[model samples]
Target: MTDAIKANIEKILQDSHVGPMATVQNDKPHSRYMTFFQENLKLYTATSKETHKTEEVEKNPFTHILLGYEGDGFGDEYVEYEGKVTISNSDELKKQLWIEDMKHYFDGPEDPNFIVLEIEPIQIRLMNKKGKAPKVLEL
Candidate 1:
């Protein structure tokens, strides 16, 4: 059962690159859409060092992510990712997740202001697939 859920989650992560990432600020939930890159069960998204989300994560590591709906309608499967976020300036990772579109935000992956938020999921729930109850994966 766990294997099936893990595989389902993996496929969701791979197919769902864009999602809303929510963080806490002043005890209020702050959320914004972001393009995500995944490695195994981990997720990464790029942002500027000065972004509000960056500061929010430093103060509060907890985050919630929703990804993997194809927008075809009610049956589209998705995953809810609840995790801890870490800010990273490592060029190795920056290069790995970099894309030409990012040029508008920074000079390059080496830009000092370029940073990535690393999210490690504490719980993942497979959602909205065939009307079944949400299957959870707790790490």
Candidate 2:
């Protein structure tokens, strides 16, 4: 990735933390808005172990995520992220991904039902920027 592309991607990751994450189930796409925490290019999102997503990911570990589009139509930038998923319930990660808002869904970081989905990127693209075409980040 070029410096500009990398910078834009970092901006997006910093600016956009909430977006739809898609997983495959029964050969169909299942998507839901999730809050993500990223490190380098890896992304992680907390979810319930009992959720359909956890099961779907177990069957098919692939996922696609869309982040950084805040609905401003005119040349707004966004990211198209395609990756592999790993369901994690490690206390370390649960604690790391814990946030106050998640209390609505989880009791706490140690909540037995709480789990995280760790995404390992397979492909990523910076999309819909002013005049440039979609740019794929080499990884």
- Who wins the lDDT comparison? 1
Model 1, span 1-139: residue lDDT tens: 9999999999989988999999999999999999999998999999999899988998999999999988888778999999999899898999999999999999999999999999988999999887889999968
**lDDT, residue 135, candidate 1:** 92
Root-mean-square deviation (CA) per prediction: 0.9, 1.1
lDDT tens string, model 2, 35-70?
A: 999999899999888889999999999999999998
Question: Relative to the true structure, how large is the alpha-carbon lDDT of every model?
Answer: 0.93, 0.90
Q: Give the TM-score of candidate 1.
A: 0.96
- Report the error of model 2 at residue 29, Å: 1.0
* Deviation from truth (RMSD, Å), model 2: 1.1
Q: Which candidate has the highest TM-score of all?
A: 1
Off by over 4 Å in 2: none
